[model samples]
Target: MTPTLSEVTVGDELPALTVPVTRADLVRYAGASGDFNPIHWNERFATEVGLPDVIAHGMLTMALAGRIVTEWAGDPGAVARYSVRFTRPVVVPDDGVGTEITVTGKVAAINEDGTVKVTITAKAADQAVLGGAQAHVRLP
Candidate 1:
């Protein structure tokens, strides 16, 4: 169920989420997004670019972080605005297991317009992938 405005408050933390990002997932995302960047799929190119390995797309990491709030609000449309800065890359090795991303969210402020400002932290392999991540969400 969607959370009511009154039920939310500053410092209220949403449930944490974890998602595994695989090479196949990157390929699919590239196909859907028309971002056939070599660094995302080519290990040699990524290495040449100084990246540890093939990395997940920044937008993918942002979307995964947003999922933590959307799931808590129980409605995708409830999110009014979302933004994040790419800080680190999420390395996805060729191993089938892939890399895991962890997202944690908290209510940062309650807005006068029945919306809440949520602060989000996203990490992969103990390194932050997104910086200054926050979402503005409308409540019921």
Candidate 2:
């Protein structure tokens, strides 16, 4: 069930989510998103371009973070507005266990229209990956 307007508070926090990013995951995302940027799949090319390693797509990271909001809202369509800035590249290594991105959200404000503003924080390797992440969600 979705959270009701009365059950939400300004500082209420959503459960944190951690998503793993691997080279294979990036490859699949590249195929689906048509974003075959060399930096996302080609390590040599990425290194030449000054990237520490092959990195996950910015949109992929954003989608993972957005999942938290959608899940908490209990309906994907409940997200009325969402935005974020790609602050850092999520370095995905080619190993058994790749790096993980963590997403956490807090209810920032409750709007008059029954929509709540959710402030999001996404991090990878203990550093912020997305900046100014926010989502507006309508409650049941």
Model 1 lDDT, residue 72, Cα: 93
**Residue 37, model 1: Cα distance from true site in angstroms:** 0.5
Model 2 sits at a Cα RMSD from the real structure of 0.8
Could you give candidate 1's per-residue lDDT for residues 1-140 as a string of tens digits? 56789988799999899999999999999999999999999999999989999999888888888999999989999899999999999999998999999999999999888789999999999989999999999888
> Candidate 2 residues 58-100, lDDT tens each?
9999999999999998999999999999999999887868899
lDDT of each: 0.92, 0.94
Worst 10 residues of 1 by lDDT: 1-10
lDDT value, residue 60 of candidate 2: 96
Best model number under lDDT: 2
TM per candidate comes to 0.97, 0.97
Question: Each model's RMSD to truth, in Å?
Answer: 0.8, 0.8
